[model samples]
Target: MEARVEVSPEQEARRIAAVRRYDILDTPPDGAFDRIAALAARLFDVPVATVTIVDTDRVWFKAAYGLAGVTQVGRDPGLSTSAILTDGPLVVPDTLQDPLARDHTLVTGETRARFYAAAPIVTRDGHRLGTVDVMDTRPRRTTPEQAGALADLAALVMDELELRLTALRMLRVERELVVVEHAARERAERDRAEIAAYAATLQRTLLPPALPEVPGLEAACHYTTASVRDVGGDFYDVFPLGTGRWAFFLGDVSGRGAPAAALTSLIRYTLRSTALLQPDPCAVLRALNAALLSESADGSRFCTLIFGTLVPHPAGGFAITLTGGGHLPAYRLHPARRDGPSQALARAEPVSLPGGMLVGALRQADFTSRPVRLLPGQALFLYSDGLIEARTSRGARFGEESLAAHLTHHAATNRALGAAAIIDDLTVLLDSFAAGPADDVALLALSAATATPTTAPSGASGTAHTSLPLPARHSM
Candidate 1:
């Protein structure tokens, strides 16, 4: 009678489940597994080596070396199956002579394997999934070193399965992240476009629709914003105060965007109201300084301003008194004089005011006025720091010296340089010097009319002479 083969149904069920979890049965030969199997055959001096996964009724070869065209064999209660069942290494020398393999086909059939050794491919959870096994037709015994090598090779096969699972998980996560990033970028682009449009509209409302015409005077103004997406801090306006007197102010706030724009509007309206109440250039500036200081509790906001009162003189010219609050000095361009037979020359005189503290910065601010005469055929130019701070392509600054040279050249060429002509020439010069301006530029040019006009300068001619409402007082 044949010896009965023992089997444990519960343990066998779990072992089969672990083998299926790897999904390695009946798969095409992989280079990694094939290479290890070939190395095993060479190391053990065997005719055949295989990476075998035991199934329910048969054993499947994932990788085979030195074997004929066979992919699978019956799972007899033999060496390879014993390695899987016991979850350990098994070695049988002369399988035909061994009781464990006496009735096995591998020993009784044509492919009579006399020797067999195998190591279990165990998972971290102690589940034996498969085996790395070597077989030979002649009887042989395995050294302890050879047995350990077979066990090491089996562990390496399990590592390859773990790596494949990890790579697949990472690939899935990367794909999901790409989808999320694309959606976020699209939403941000839409928001940016809407913000740019709103900023442009707000910028237009803050500036004068057109420059006001002053009686007996010709005035022009220009504003260049550094970017269309953001509002600038620079502002300028020319409006009548009352009683044959006119007020004009130009200033630059501390920063850019909506906050700076709000401050610009406040400064502009405050100057108009204060000029009407006091009319004195120094007094008007003092009132503005007080208002600014009260408003800027955080101390981050301030401005440099040049405020002036234009009174018609009994003589031909206008008596202009101006107060400066940490602003650049104004320039008076004189008419050209014939120097020689061919050359003509002109001069740019600096109209300097006593230095005062910046508006919106101090509890108490000091301001002073200097009286100047603006005659016919001569022009007065007021500009923000942006004009002088511009840079050339070669990184040279268009400083005070360069500005003075430009003014002198234009005055010499056009002996009677009007306000309009000065603004036009300066705009061209700035554009040529810098392809893109680094900051906002505000320019205001005033000149006495050379020829007497029939109509008095009024709001109809882009100049406003109406009394403006006083700004409402607010708690800082």
Candidate 2:
């Protein structure tokens, strides 16, 4: 018969203190610990497995497998409480035959647990707080390898607890600093203005200062924020690929403030670097999806984006292939066919892209690309959801149909309107809104530069230039 182990009064008090120090009891279930418990059950071929913390009055189950709806039991007759009384693994081949556990409530009551094994979850300083245990209804014996594996699992749980404790401590320190800063700042207005300025500066760093000049292609972009106090998620960029091709993208991240800005920077870097190696629009986006999924395993961050490549066509202007990832549809504006000297505007055509699923939402998401050609006097316009979802002065949503009609009107009235002119007109419209745009607005336009302007519109200058100011807050 094996001798029973006893813990001193001081030792038991230290163990309870260790459990409280971890701050893990009564907390929400953790995925990592649950997985460990499930794995332990499978390894020992037992019907029940649990990671438990032995408390003063109860044995609390942090993670349980095959023990449904049972959160805790009285400390005295609990298997976990007995397991923690020893310094090493306690394996009872048959509960009915073991002198120490034979009269335990778990064995004499409805549980009828015949076989049991557990490794004490001991901290680095030799304080046993809990156990990693498995129970079976039938008598069984475990090999040395199985017992050692159980100990390893207990060590893993301790490591996880230590990591969680470190994270909690850091969060508490950050909260304390925030409290001190709040108390120090006496003027609310000064704090508000400083935060807005900082947000604006950070947002500008996420985008290119000026659109790159693509040969034979005129590009212009403008950004308008709905509120200066809040950091918006809209971003866009155009860059050359060095292979006689150019790449551009416009998108909105899923959040605001520092997290959104960080995500925006990561997305831009991933897209640019991935496109250099594999320039296919769909493939590049796939790489980005993989990067995002790997970085954010919880799927907390995502974006709606349109990625495209522009190549100089031998026949005329440029050939553009675009792929959408759950983003708004882009519009193509055609110049009126001239039977004589009179010029008019053609209706806008919405690009229909099939199989474009939300990126970073799933591992097997599909993105499709569509090819379009840009002729002279034709332009491709891309804008974020803020444009259409914005509320007009009349309190009605400025929907897609209304936006299309407005674009057609401007194209017809302004004969010299190119990429820059189009963006300028939209910026003015956004500023005129009574409430300004309810969200951040980003406008990107690419047009084939015409050789000569037939007639300059009323507000038109000599010719529309792609050069525009850097991203600045346009909302009043």
Candidate 3:
């Protein structure tokens, strides 16, 4: 005879719902749960121990020890199912003698469990989810101390499940954060690329399209930007001002990037417009100074410039008048004797101009001009401060004295080098001086043609000269 086990549908439904909430069904075995089960079996001296969750129709083992190749067992009115219904430990001493276990399948079938002891796995809300159970093939009984240890092991299993759930939630949050950061980085890169493209186009518009053909002279110019992502402050132009006269200017604004580019465009147009109206070097600079001062109310903007005008001289070459507004002095490269050996030692001399205050600083700006002669076989070199301020690998500044020495050396070696060749050689030298230039450099060279008389082209001034196409822009 066996004692009947009562079943309550409402309580069983609530227990099943709480078990499902944990979402541990059909999960792989964990080392923590396995250790608990093994410890329970050893403490109770049983051959089978399992950490089981009681489901709707079966008892699933999350971890099992001493059960050979068994992961689950049916819950057809068995002792494990009865443990799920209890709030505390359920101990069956000698299942063959106890009325509740005498006819159970675990006792009569191949397992032949004669003893059973289980501690219910209960939630904080007082719902039973499963059991930590120990069983034996031979009839036995559980001591009071052994039952208490089994109950402690059941509590440990629940703690392990809570840790696993916390870890899974943290991993999900970390993955989502990684995805968002990657998207933000991509968007930033695209925005920088677009800004660079726009800056490049605007920089081109600020310079002249081409150097106009100056009669009785050879001209060449080069511009280098320190960065393509931001516009540079250096600018230059050589354009015809009408009536066989031409105006040329080279300047550097106070800063770099889009703000400087905007001001550069304004200065360029202002200079062109002012020069056409006055046609005098000093007068043109005064007009520019007034314009810049008017625009810079916050005292944040200014420019250093050298403006010049060229006209063919009746005596021999072109007569040049230059006005400086706190700008670097220009250099005149004189060739060796034309009647003597073709490669005589050449000379370089600084063409000094009257120094004035920086443009846009004062309302009554004072500007002065100096007259210079560019005879045949002579050239004038104008450059921005970037050339003299460039640094070498050893961190020493390449000052004006070093530049003068280099110019003298090149002229002594290459007597036939024209304005274009001089610019090319200087550019190569600058590149070799540093790994990369850290500032914007602008170079312009104008040379009077040699005394060889040749036929001029149709509809052109009676002067013979050759021109070369401009080189591509370089971005540091």
Best by lDDT: 2
Residue 79 of candidate 1: its Cα lDDT? 60
TM-score of each: 0.55, 0.57, 0.56
lDDT of 1 by residue, 380-399 (tens): 89999988888865778889
The total of clashing pairs for model 2 equals: 0
Error of 1 at 102 (Å): 99
User: Which lDDT values do the candidates have, in the order given?
Assistant: 0.74, 0.78, 0.74
lDDT of 1 at 153: 76
What is candidate 2's lDDT per residue for 29-86, written digit by digit as tens? 8756776787789788888999999999898999999888888877865367778867
Candidate 3: stretches off by over 4 Å? 1-185, 338-345, 453-476
Model 2 reaches what TM-score against the true structure? Answer: 0.57
Better of 1 and 2 by TM-score: 2
lDDT value for model 3: 0.74
**Which wins on TM-score, candidate 2 or candidate 3?**
2
The worst-scoring run of ten residues by lDDT in candidate 3 lies at 460-469
